[model samples]
Target chain A: MTGASPADTAVQGTVAQPEWQQLDRRSIWVAPVQPLAGLLLAGLVAITFRGWDRFGVIEPAIGAAVAIGVFALSAWHWRTTRYRITPTHVEMTSGMLVRKHRSVARDRLRSVDLTSDVVHRLAGLSVVAIGTGRQGGESDDELKLDSVTTEEAERLRRLLLDRGSRAPAVAVADPGGPAEPAPLARFEASWVKLAPLSIMGLVALAVLAGGAAQLARSVGGDEIWRSGPVRGAWDWVVATPILTVVIGGLVGLLVLNAVLSTVLYVLFYGGYTLVRADDGTLRISYGLLTQRSVSIEERRIRGVRMDEPLMLQLGRGARLRVVAAGLGTKDGEGKEKKDSDMLLPTAPAAVAHRVTADVLGTPTSPVGAPMRRHPVAALRILLLQGVSLALVPAAVLLMLALVGLVPHWIWQVLLLLVVPAVVGAWLEYRNLGHARVGEFLVAQGGPAGRHTVAVRTDGIIAWQFRRTVFQRRPRVLTAIAAVAAGKGTQTIKYALQDDVLPVARDCVPGLLDPFLEPDHP
Target chain B: MRLRPPNNPVHPRATTWWRLQDAGFYLVVLVVAAGALFWVSTAWLVGVVAVIVVVGAVDIVVTPPIRYRKHRWEVTDQAVYVRTGFFVEDWRVAPLSRVQTVDTKRGPLQQWLGLSTVTITTASTAGELKIKGLERGFAAELVEQLTAATEATPGDAT
Candidate 1:
């Protein structure tokens, strides 16, 4: 199919410009409110410590004036900032002292993502983020225009996509025609949405149990709950069940948590709808508690991974997480968060593959061989875990012996650690495997759960073969693969014959060329 | 794509300095671990310190050499060749046409010693090929050369 060129898509009809309107003044309050909240809390603490009488009437009046001044200054700054979307580009200029101007070329725009939190929604404004593929000689290319009208945002999206289609290209088609939108996938909310409810219920139960234990202790003894340690045997008896029942309740709560989690997942993802725009952008709108709309361009996706939790694999449910760069949210620490990169929560394996192929243009290939660890590796992991557990009892006995109170029945502690070690090792043995299916390399291993990480060779940014002197003795090596996301690194520890390195080296370059080569696919 | 010889090859002079620095680092780590073991009585603390020192030393000593015997770079074609390591050797072939940016940096010591480092970032991965201990002029020239090559290539409309 020939895509419409930017020139052909340019508006041929008369262009209408909307009247310049100022956003709601209240919207400006958000920026200042954040800092003000901290200041207000600090002021309250100081006032409480000093006492109202200590400050007199002047203190209250001064506090009120200072709060108002801070709010006013923030509001003024917010009002001065302005953003405009024209037929050619989206421009924004903000700042009171050092003015900043950002203009995103409509013809170069990839996609526009709009997000609104509770405050933004109440103020009827949204944060708009326009993604532009890597630009030459520019470090910061993504333009984010916060606090804009929903209508203006829509217009900007249309303008950018329209102009982008007209940019010079080898092949130009009917750009004036409306781009054909991709078919929207319809989904329904399922009972699995109740998962959150179950989780909340468990939390409530724990809170109640703790409260009950405190009440019992208060009535039984004159001692306060916070007062030092319990000395009497009766006190120990009372606290032990309080702790046991709480711990036991949590253990019992897991099944319910899983069920409730599943329910909640079903509720939100049950009626999921993913639509594709004529301009080749995917729009995902889902959720029950808080609905979210995510728009991503087809070219923006780096890779797709299909995950099957043990339970999900049995029931035919798979989680699809997309590894896309740029589309992420910042955490409280201002570091970019990875959770936002997920394109799909969970879907059938077949549906996940279809979405991957359609959105990412990845060739349909069989899942790679399951990469597994050598049997010795599992034994090594088990032995390490066993030793760690055994150390606890050994330490306890050693401490007792040092104090001249060593018990004759120290052998009982050894039995306590060995059983779990044996069981854990068996679990580890069940979990490791790796495979190479066509161009994709899949690796899986862990304890009770398996993590199958699959990536196309082209998507790999770097691969390193590492070996320790000890590992070399055992003829084992580790392969670390790096992806585009600044996420650290994923290493696959495996044992292979010495002759296998050449084969691996040859296979890796060919697979990674697509991702590493600038012009070749 | 026209490929050309690499402009910045690992200087033979830098290898001796690198080896000396690596050895010094390991020696300091060994001394610290031995001191900590003698001072700390806590088993956990001692164990942790021992693991850290041993792993750090082994990692430094066993790491592949920094020098690349065969290196190539083509400014016109936008590609680079880097072959490194002593025993388990590796060859990295990257294209500047695919590179997103070229970052040049110099630490205090490197600056005083008249050396800089260049990192070439690509779109698919964060891991970039880093060439260190190059003369400052060469690093800047490499950046300018790579930038010109990148700009010359026709932008992909996709």
Candidate 2:
């Protein structure tokens, strides 16, 4: 019923009707793991709350029923799922009852991703997803294949992304270049040294601590507090000098955070590689256990953002992410989404610039170019804002102290925080800069770590200038370059109107001309 | 250096429309505050009601004309320019080549005032540029002009 038209067949060349392919048989084994794990976790929670001695056959019987149901559904899904790649479109038909058919035009294909979690990896299967750059309803836009052989996944990625310009054609297209070039970037083992600088370890630690706390609560909170080692530690903590104990705890936490972050870094980016294939596609593949590879047409990349956390900046490290249309923001999309645009994981700043330069096809990275600093009035405004923010807590604490509800030193300490706030605002002002280099508009700003984004001037669709009443006195405004990719807006926050107007005019010639008035002498 | 305001002003009825909208919002607030009088002291209720009424009156009276003056829009062959907001003024410009869609919307309030809002959208996630409260006929013309201009240009709008 869902057959191709004559035009589709013509576009496909000799193949009139391509044979529909089945998912790898191993997917049935892989699919049940998720549902079974969920059930198992529920059972474990129940057992923990009820006590192990109360464990009965009822739970096992329900677990068995769920396991069988999930297994049968998985087998049915495997049996019914079928997909085919014609010259014009990649099509998939799947469903036990609803019979859903999804197809994406070949020309509109924006990305092809292959991700394998631990279960799929163990089963030697990969989930392939093809994106066509449609906005809204992320799941509906992509054609997802639950599980396929790794080899088949790679073949599909190559075939879809590198259709017109294969390796030989690319060599012919650029006679000066080699047939196969080295990868643009690769993981360095020493990168783990910089892990402690990243907050990833602290984030993991927080998650682990939260989970452990929840689990302990479920298992009975009193039992843990009454336990021998915990009780002994509690007694020790009570007996120790307060300052000494606080310092020791901080030191231990730092050490633990360092170790955890390092392990997480290794697990997340163990074999990271960013390669621009001969056919002009950027391929990024990484991960230790649950491997993921994403291939995006290089032309789709509108810009790149180099992220430098305060600690990472101190270590002279940065992370690079591609600003592209198809890959949605990590948080904007729900969790379990494998759309990652990380061109280079946390690495040396120099390495990040080099990779960025290579990827953007510029002689030198635009982000490193000399930037025009924001007006000093911007610094003054930031200082005022930061000081005012700090004053709020100090004032509240002072009122509490006066009422004898809190210690006096607490408010004093809170007041002292103004110094750091001032310093932070100053750093942010120092980082406030924008530059137009070649065809890229680069903007860098942040309170702690700087984020320097270099957006392709042509990618910018519009310009927006915002000025609050407070900024009118300084003749300062925030200029946002609205592009279709990445976060979709690159902002030069708090710049003099004079500075940004000309920059905006030059960034995309004539777009802002209609709105700007003549400059006064 | 400052941006010259866009060339066209919205319909005069826009002020009345805005006043009605603000009045409706303040009415709801007044009702809520009056309800809360039963739960709290009369002094607190009076204070809350006074603040709300004062703000609402200011918003309804002082803001409408200022907003009407500030809100302007212009469309050239090359681009669409719009200026909006009173306290926090904003100027936006989108090239015709990058405009993906042009639409006109009219709420019940706007319909009563014979006003329509024309929205110009680009592929950018910065969102659409809306020139609110234009005469309905003029709004339609603006949408038609924008649609034609965007259609004539030949890019993916990305």
Candidate 3:
């Protein structure tokens, strides 16, 4: 391990690379493949040329011309863009007609992520996206350095966030001392089984199976059904008894979803690894094809979230996520969701707690903390919502049945479902709970998922309190703790007036001073 | 049916602000009702309009005072506390450190009445907290104090 003075390194860096460093030549190749829409458009054109009646047979020369044109245009775009890096800031100069010069200070830089798609991987290049810790509507704060060499991408990740100097790029001391990063956590084989248990998986399977059936009926013709494997499965379905077939199909679909989701999980997170960098940053790299590396600064992470999906909850499985800012949360980018604040995919309950404790630097598990329950008003509201919603159909059917306009069975069916509706609402009210654990506030609730989010109180930026008309009678209101990180707001619905104030006081202490009269929520 | 709120309420002059806004609303409604007066077949539409106008007139006259009483706010060294709404009251407390922007807006009607709306923005998902119908001078003072407080607090580590 070498500890080079960052100041000395900066002086040496200017002589070698004067102002800017040019990207790899392979970027020109990647440029054409960058916009996914272009590829999709090309596919559409090819399909229409072959299948559409009006298009008829397309000449091969026209196809080649379009391909060459797109590639040439992309190359020209690549030629125009340039960038410069100093110890303090990274400056970018892009665009030909409308010039764009974006400069980001090294200290202000939030997170550096490297991503590679099928095209980028094939070309041995990666796209780097650097984000600033700014909220939405501040889009210009991010820098997208596309199609850099894989090695350069790695170097940039370390250098841009070096904090010390541009020349002494790597950290001075190798604390871990391992030739490779010691894997803090890895996806267990059992995580695949969780895919089947989730409602989303079941719903997706149903949709897929329905689509296949529809496709078989309308498009592909009898030859598709005669295919060897599908034929065997179809024959078995037909041979079984009607009741057996119905039950077996459901079970089969669940199994298929489990296997499918597991395969999907493995493909995305097969070599999943969370490594602690020498500088205390947690660097995560994963995915089978579209390799991605995400770096989160130690201080940026506020807390952890534990989600127990209903199906997975039964089996003691949970998913873990980090509560942090500067992780892309807006809906526009598909990359954000893929590489966002994910700490772990599905894992056992114990493992989830262990990882959370490790991340927060706590000796005890994050789970099993005592929580404060909502007032009875919450239950009343839930029951009102559930019963009133369920009764509307029942009343309509009953009225129609009295006039002999509808069958009596309709009313009976509606009546039969009412109990379950009320029970579901009650369960939701029962789940609503909030607690203050040391410097963290745990907001937990939900009928199905039972989401438990533990956020550091210091990370909370504001508090919003609500007092509804119905809740007034029971002296209860809702409190929303807004943080700059993650989903942004944590809610504690139907809290008593006495309870919420203390919670607010605990979260922000002197933020809501005693000078102000006791507020509603 | 009202929820018990904090002691410090909005400016007493806010009733004038509410009444002015209510009058403007009623003016629009009256214009439409007058136009409809000629087209009704059985005069039932006119009857309904008369009933609505009467109820609205009562609401405009009686509700402002209730609203003024319900609305509350207080500024401490570290945060801004506000409770508003005559029916569904909402209370908000935002730390000075989290304060991103602060502004005071005065609409034409409010300008005539010497009143302004104070808006406090934080990095929270709940959006902005606004205390409407404060004395113009008080609102300005609030903006200045809040801005100073925000600047004094250190950078958010997040």
Query: Could you list the CA RMSD of all candidates, in the order they appear?
Result: 9.5, 4.0, 5.5
Worst 10 residues of 1 chain B by lDDT: B67-76
Q: Candidate 3 chain B, which ten residues in sequence have the lowest lDDT sum?
A: B1-10
Ranking by TM-score: 2, 3, 1
Model 3, position A288: C-alpha lDDT score: 88
Model 1 residue A449 lDDT score: 47
**Mind giving the per-residue lDDT tens digits that candidate 2 earns over A1-521?**
13333234334365557678888888998978976886688677667556778767876887798798889999999999999878777888999999988788887888888999899888788998787776534332677788898877776776677566343442244422475567888899888789888888888888878977887776677766776778899999999999999999999988988888888889988999888786778989899987988888888999999999888988999999999886654322344453467788889999999999999999999998999999999998999999999889989989999989999998888888899889999999989999999999999998878999999999889999998888898899899999888777999999989988998999888778767787573
Q: Is model 1 an incorrect, acceptable, medium or high docking prediction?
A: incorrect
Model 3, span A432-500: residue lDDT tens: 888888888888888746888888888888878787677777878787888887777888878776786
The C-alpha TM-scores of every prediction are: 0.64, 0.90, 0.82
Which residue pairs in model 2 clash with each other? none
Q: Model 3 clash pairs?
A: none
| Candidates 1 onward: DockQ, in order | 0.16, 0.75, 0.45
**Poorest lDDT segment (10 consecutive residues) of candidate 3 chain A:** A1-10
Worst 10 residues of 1 chain A by lDDT: A512-521
Measured by TM-score, the strongest candidate is 2
The chain A TM-scores for the candidates, taken one by one, are: 0.64, 0.87, 0.80
| Docking quality level of the chain pair in candidate 3 | acceptable
